[model samples]
Target: MKFPTVRHCWTAFLLLLASGLSAKEVPPPPDPPRLVNDFVGLLSRTESQALENKLVAYDDSTSTQIAIVIERSLEGDDIFDYSFRLAEAWGIGRKGKDNGILIYIAFEDRQIWIQTGSGAEGFLPDVMAKRIIDNIIVPAFRQQAYFQGLDRATDAIMQLGSGEFEPEGLGKKKISAARVIFFIVLLIVLFILLSRMGGGGGGGYYRGGRYDRGGGWIWWG
Candidate 1:
């Protein structure tokens, strides 16, 4: 009787890996009852209603959909993957526009993710999303101000979606321009130094090769 071949063993290992991955796939929660689904009871009834109303009005006016989901835990699944699957399953945005945003919070895992539809990515980019998480949400959550965090973060998202506010990076273009100017100036200075060093009398001369003058070696081309 011949033992299992290496190829057979490798194929068996791949199958086991696939089975493990399938086991870890967690099903998304049920369809959202409203724009805000706080399954963990993180928000009070009044707070949820107020947020829901605000989101409803925004959606009604702009037709851009934003949904918030707060789960007790992600059930040992990756938050990004779970959020992407959830957003896909829920069909959160308009069909053609694909302008949807899903703010997912895994309370027990202490992980939060913002999944934006293709159309919405232009307005709410990864940098802006990171800013919202770091500057607004995380700070408020750290102080146990979950409602405040969500409220402010959603407000920012709405402002971006509605074109009421520009992302912080917009202003950074000026800084980048200034840096370009600085880099140009630096290059000019380097060119001047190189010219002066290579221009003087017999001290330095270009011979289409490397030259050493007891000070240092310089390549001349």
Candidate 2:
């Protein structure tokens, strides 16, 4: 076979180089299913519903968007880099405000990233994001309580956006249903005690020879 000319060889080399450069490949684009996208099925239906409600409500009120993504793997990409790429590709926050928040979880890599938009950066700085992961998320992930971790972390993030969250309170661990129920019961008991103490002073404890206002012995005593 005859050898190729210099111009032909140069063209072939350039083409090959261009193809190799293109083949290097960028991160994949994001196609979010909804406000909460659980690709890995980490969240049950109920958990998903709870997060959706919280996110929807926050968005409705503040026009700030938040989304969750759970993936089995990041396809060998770094989670932090993948998170930024996904957030940018998804166009999550408002165009002008840039108030979007992304909660990205890669279970296979045991990595979590809280990606915030320009508006959110004021509330959720990189330092705060790391703290949320370390204090709120990693502990629950360690215990396999992904739902609790996400729920509380979302709440804390929302509180941050609202400017009501105290950095000192980050130390508080996840609150359990049982603890909530106990708090409700304790409040109810306190309310009853206060009501009994009031004892309807308009009419004395004993009126018209009957306990008109305070029927209980404790109230009278």
Candidate 3:
């Protein structure tokens, strides 16, 4: 019986290895930055009429998510009020080495307004809010795309928000441990397979080449 030629055998083995690897799934990328405007703070900064007007413009007559609440004063160490639980807040609020981005919003003169957190206050000055309305939000609104405008505006804001480094201490260590475990498992599996393929009563490759138990011959140098 003629088994596959040497070159064909090597080619087939490589193909099999490639096919096996292709079955593995790739992990997804991280989520994009989110927009988390503190509603209470926003209202305190702007007039209610103007805030409502802006909402109508942004929401295109559907601004339900934006809530208007009567905020009571909270001390320096007080519970956060009217703060939405945005997914991005995990990476935002009190960012480790990475300073957090806290967008403060409140009613000012009965209008909806926002103030970037102290850390980010310098970058996204309240003064820029006017430009944001003119350049970003207004354009999105004019196109009759409120949600899309929010995304565009927030994305642009986040672009400005980035650049601060955030180091996850214990969290980073945990991730490292996970990678170590994965590598150990992979090594263990590879060694187990190699051992089964050799050091057993079977035909397998060795230091120099395969050992043919039946033939008991060094097939070729």
Candidate 4:
């Protein structure tokens, strides 16, 4: 039997090193006991049970899954990537619907990520996700109200997912449109009253001989 060559030994050494690195970097996915996984001990027993019950009821009613995971650290991994991996590994949502949301909080890393599965993206887009974190979760977290933040954020997600109400931004847009329409109508009414007050002579208009209306400019005769 011929001994292994120097190149063969070096190649084997490199392969072993690569395998070890891979094992270290890519840790095994978490096996959560329930929908709420407080690996970091952020939530108390009562809080965890309350959150889990809410999540379970929401899933039962709508068939959409929402999971909350609080970890002490991400082990230097990117929060977004790690959260996505966790969601995939756990299969949080139904198989075909894929309507799942993962709320991941890393205490040491000081990061929060909301990962929505494909089917749930319509209800919870990236912008809305950021809004939930920035507007809802972060504020409560700043006050050290972890459970409150998680509760409110999850409530918002469930409401949006179930179509109980429009997303905040979308709702704001609708309100804005309604305001614009009201303002336009008010302007039209004011213009008509002013025109009547001027008494019959159409030559003297608000601005030259043209009126800038909603759709386009109208030449006033």
Candidate 5:
């Protein structure tokens, strides 16, 4: 068998190297700024400072931690997965609360993901998270106003976390008196159902004393 030419061998080696590189996983970018990490250097010094101050204030007041990260790209990793991992790695929230929130933006991919920890889910659920991205962040991003987008989005998130932010129109709907009354009625009905299920008529006497306490039969020693 004839040996391949040197050029052909070099080309094959290059192809193999490329294949290996493609299969390798790309690690997440470093967190130099800690609070607001712009790995791709997208934000200006002033913009970064402003965002850092906003987040610091938010944390100080509510103890709810929020982090913003902007990367040129995540290579091949899914943003949702990357966000969660980054939050976990950074320990963004308090130890016991797990209330961290991560705002991940991939510029090249044109994708964003809001990752909320267990503690934050109460304040920022899936719907609210998506709304902030779709309405607030995406709009600014489309206009090529990254700083504005990040600033507004962060403010909105902080407000929502503190229960102070409410969007107009759909988000501003107040609970009517009728709805409040209906909710109370529903709770009363649920309580009755649960009581019936739990109270088994006190059929068995534990200690030979049948005690009728407040219209409910109780058997105790």
Candidate 6:
């Protein structure tokens, strides 16, 4: 009987090796959170409403708190500069890079106006982000659910905004989440150690290899 050639044997071996290799798992995209404090520059703009000290509501019809950014153009060499007027027309108006903008929001003519910056990275998409603010942030504010709306807005911001040098959002100032976790673990270890001080006479865990109630040198039962 005729046998397979060397090339055929090589091909068979390669096929077997490929089959043995498990498919590479495509990891889910990073969802790091974005906070306002991360930005190098920060500004807030608020407008006064001629109302008494009563509760004020913010909805699609009334937006109480809003933020806006005015960006400048980056030269051909300095790639950090981001365009003001983008193709999507998501209120990316023109204004030289001299100034950054901040706008306190108020709904008008059934439409929301947003200004994004070349600096902000990983933020909600302009149009969608605007919609989220209108539908979620505003209503939550009206209901006094400030944290809820703020959390949602923050999460969205991290996903769509842009960065200056690093396309990722800015690193937070306070302790990182990992650091906080490590601290908690350390605290637990300390607590356990303190509890197991074993203050003499059947104090520590396991007195007589089983259990002895009398607080003495546990007599073998």
Best by TM-score: 1
* lDDT string, candidate 4, 4-107, tens digits: 23543454356446545342133354555479988888899999999999999998898888889888877755455456657776778878887888888878
lDDT of each: 0.71, 0.69, 0.36, 0.71, 0.69, 0.31
Pairs with steric clashes in candidate 5? none
Model 5 C-alpha lDDT per residue in residues 116-219, reported as the tens digit of each score = 77777777776777777777777787787889988988888777776889976317677899999999999999999988898766565466421111101111
lDDT per residue, candidate 1, 3-86, as tens digits? 123543354356446546652354454555578888899999999999989988887898888889888877766555566667
Clash totals, every prediction: 0, 0, 24, 0, 0, 15
Q: Which stretches of candidate 2 lie over 4 Å from their true place?
A: 1-33, 167-221
Model 2 TM-score (2 dp): 0.62
The digit string of per-residue lDDT tens for model 2 on 111-200 reads: 677777767777877667767777778878888898998998888888887778776745445889999999999999999998988876
Between prediction 1 and prediction 6, the one with superior TM-score is 1
- Poorly placed runs, candidate 6 (over 4 Å): 1-103, 106-113, 119-124, 162-221
Better of 1 and 3 by lDDT: 1
* Greater-TM-score candidate between 2 and 6: 2
Model 5 scores a TM of 0.65
lDDT (tens digit, per residue) of candidate 3 on 1-221: 12123543464356446555332221121244222333344223334444444444432332111222322222221112112122123343333222233322222222122323334444454445334544555555456544454445444444444533222220113458889899999999999998888774866556652321110111010
TM-score of each: 0.69, 0.62, 0.28, 0.65, 0.65, 0.24
| Alpha carbon deviation, residue 1, candidate 6 (Å) | 80
Instruction: Give the root-mean-square deviation of each candidate in angstroms.
Output: 16.4, 25.5, 26.1, 18.7, 20.2, 24.7
Superior by TM-score: candidate 2 or candidate 3: 2
Tens digits of lDDT, candidate 6, 1-221:
11123443354345435546332222221244111211112122111111101112221122221233212211221111111122112222123321121222222211223333332212322344445556555666567554455455444443333231122232324678999999999999998897699455654455452112110111111
